[model samples]
Target: MTRSARRTRRALQAAGAGAAALLALSACSSSDSDSGSTTSGSSASSSSSPKLSGDVTVFAAASLQESFTTLGKEFEKAHPGTKVTFSFGGSDSLAAGITGGAPADVFASASPKTMAIVTDKKDNATVPATFVRNQLEIATLPGNPDKVSSLKDLTRSGLKVVLCDKTVPCGAAAQKALDASKLKLTPVSYEEDVKSALNKVVLKEADAAVVYKTDVKTAGSKVEGVDFPESADAINDYPITLLKDSKNPETAKAFIALVQSAEGQKVLSEAGFLKP
Candidate 1:
C-alpha cells in the first residue's frame, strides 16, 4: 500500500478510538449523574418523613378504653418497633397522676374540664384538642329488667342507681343533666369512673347507671342503654394532648394524630362516641 494511504488509515483508526473513548466517558458521567440524583432524592424524602419509635404510655379516660385500645393496635401496626401502654381511669384521677409527676406520654380525657387540669399546669406540650363528644345514657341490666326508661325513673324507690362522682367527667355530666331536668337523684353509690358505674349495673348491684353512651355500647348485652333528652344538655367534650414530660414526644404526637385522623374517628364513632 502507498505510504500516504497507510498514514491516512492509521490516522482514521486513531480518531475512531478517541471518539469511542469520549462516548464511553460521556455514558459513565450520565450514569453517575443519574445515580447521584436518585440518592439525593431518596435522602430528601427520608429527611422530610417523620421518624417515630420507642414506647409510648397513654393515660386515657375510662370511657376511651375500647376505642383507644383499637387505635393503639392500629398505631403499632403502622409503626413497627413501637409499643403502646395505657393507664385507663377517671379523668380526674388521671389528671392528678399527671400533675403528680406521672411518666405518661399522652393524656386523653373524657371532658375538656378534666383536660384543663393538665393544661392549667402547663403539663401539655401542645394545646389539648377535643376529638370527640359523649352523651349520658342510663345503663341498666340486660332487657332493662327494671324497665328503667328515663332519668327520673332512676329516682324510683328501691331502684338502686349508681353514678360517677362529681369530680370525674361522667359524674359532672350526670350532674349537669340532672340539674337541667330540675330533678334531684341520690345514687346508691358514686363510682369513680364511668366504667365503674356501668359495672355496677352489669353486676346487678345497681338497677341503673348514669354513664356515657359509649360505656353502654362497650358493655354490650351485659347492660341495656336508656337514652334521655337531658343527655343533650350535658354532652362531654373529650380532649387529648401530648404531655410536656413525654419521653417519646414524637411517638406521642403521632398517636394523637392517629386519634384525630379519619380512621380514628370511624373507630370512635362505631363505639358510640359523638364527633367533635
Candidate 2:
C-alpha cells in the first residue's frame, strides 16, 4: 500500500477509536446520573410518612359524643379515604367492650379507672393520655323550674331525679361529689350513661339529672346547667389510647393525635370540656 494511503487508514482508525471512547464515557455518565436519581427518589419515598386510610373504630364515653363526633368529621375530611366510627356510651361499658375483644381501634374513657380496665388487660397499644377533664353539673328542666341550685338541692322531697349508673364514670364522679358535700341523693333511676341521665331531664321525665357539665352544654335549651362547687372535688380526667388489636392502627393513631391536638382541644373547649 502507498505510504500516504497507509497514513490515511491509520488516521481513520484513530478517529473511530476516539468516537468509541466518547460514546462509552457518555453512557457511563448517564448510567451514574440515572442511578443517583433512583436512589434519591427511593430515599424521598421512604422518608415521608404513608398516607392514612381505612376505618378507625373508636369506643368513647357518652360525654365525648359531641366533640369527638366533630373531630371524626374533621379527620375524614383531612384524609379522603378514611372514616371514623364511634361507639359512645358509659366509660365502664366501653372499657368492658374493649377488653372483651370488641375490635375497637381506640378508646377514650371519661376516667382513668375505666381506661385502666383495658390497659390492665394489655388491650392498649400505648399508655393512656389524659386529654380533658369534666366536672359534674345539675341539669334541670328548662327555666330552672325545679330551683335545683346545688348538689344538695337534688335531695329535695318528691323531685324525680336521674343519675348515671354507679358503675359508670359519671355515676362514680357524682357519688364522689355527694360524699364530698356530705350529702345524700336518691335518684328516680340510675341510667347507663351520662347522656341517658341527661336525656331524662331533657325529655321532662325527671325534674333534674346529675351529669357532666359537657352533657348539659350539649343539651342546649332542653335543660339548664347549674354549676355546683362540689363538682370541683369530683372532676373526671378523660383519657385516650390506641388499642393493641387495632385493625387500622395508623388511622387510629391519627385520630388520637387529632383528639389531643390544639385543634382538637379547641373543639373540646368549645363543647365545655376542661383541659387536662
Candidate 3:
C-alpha cells in the first residue's frame, strides 16, 4: 500500500477504537439505570433495618445559649440512639438559616417577629406557644459607679452607651422601652446582638446598654442590671416551633414539649425570664 493509504488506514483504526470505548461507557451507565428492577427489592430490606440514626440539629437564639445548652445536655441524656446539636445565634440569623434550607429539626426564637419569618415559610407549627418572656434593663459597671438611673442617662454627655441594631429582637425591645419612656438614646455603636451590647458595658467600653435581664444573670458579677418600669412595656415574648423538614420529628416534638412544660418555665425564670 502507498504511504498515504497506510496513514489513512491507521487513522480510521484509531477512530474506530475511540468509538468503541465511548460505546462501552454508555453501556455501563445505561445498564446501571436499567438494573433498578434488580436493586429495588434488596434496597427495601436494608432500609427497613433502622430509620432513626442521625443527628438532630436545633437552631436557637443567642440569648438561649446558656439555658438551652444546659437543657440540651439533659435532652441528650434522656434520649438514646439520638444526638442533639445546637446552633445558637441572633434570632433573625437562626430564622434565616431555617428558611434558607439549613438542616435543622427545631428552632427557638427570641421574638414572634423572627419566628413568624420561619412559620410563614415551611417551618410553621399550628400556633407556636410562648416559651419565655424577656425584658430589657440598663446594664452598667459593677455598682452605681456611673450613677445611671434611667434610659435618658444612656445619652448623657461623657457616658458612653451601646445598643443593639434595630434588626435584633433586643434592639427592638430597647426601642420600645425608650419609646415608652419617651427617651431618645444616642449610642456610640449599635451591636448585632444583645450580648454584644452588654459586653461593651461589662468591658467598660460603654457606660451602659439596654439588654435582657437573663443576659445580666448569665454575666455573673461582671455587670449590674437596674430595672426601669418601661421594661414592662417592652417584655419580649419567646416562641419555639418544630421545623417541618426535620430528620427526627419525634425528638423535635419532645424538645418543644419540654420547653413549654412547667419545668422549662421554671428554668427560664431562674435564668431571669419573666412569665408571659
The root-mean-square deviation over C-alpha atoms between each candidate and the true structure, in angstroms, is 4.0, 6.2, 18.2
Clashing pairs in 2: none
Top model by TM-score, which number?
A: 1
Q: Mind sharing the TM-score for model 2?
A: 0.84
- Candidate 2: lDDT of 128? 91
Write the residue-wise lDDT of candidate 2 on 117-226 in tens digits.
99998999899999999989999999999787888888989999899999999999999988888888898999999999998988899999999988889888999999
For model 3, residues 1-276, the per-residue Cα lDDT tens digits are 999999999999999999999999999989998798569977877777343345778898888888887777776776666677999878898898888999888888899999999998857654677888888888999996989887777768888888888889999998888887778788899998888888898888988888998998899899998888888898889988778888877767877777778877778788988886
Pairs of residues at least 3 apart in sequence or in different chains that clash in candidate 1 = none
- TM-scores for all candidates: the values are 0.86, 0.84, 0.78
Worst 10 residues of 3 by lDDT: 46-55
Candidate 1 residue-wise lDDT, 65-95, digit = tens: 9999999999999999999999999999999
Instruction: Identify the runs in model 1 with alpha carbons over 4 angstroms from their true place.
Output: 1-40, 47-50
Residue ranges of candidate 3 with Cα displaced over 4 Å? 1-54
Q: State the lDDT at 163 in candidate 1.
A: 90
Q: How far is candidate 1 from the true structure (C-alpha RMSD, Å)?
A: 4.0
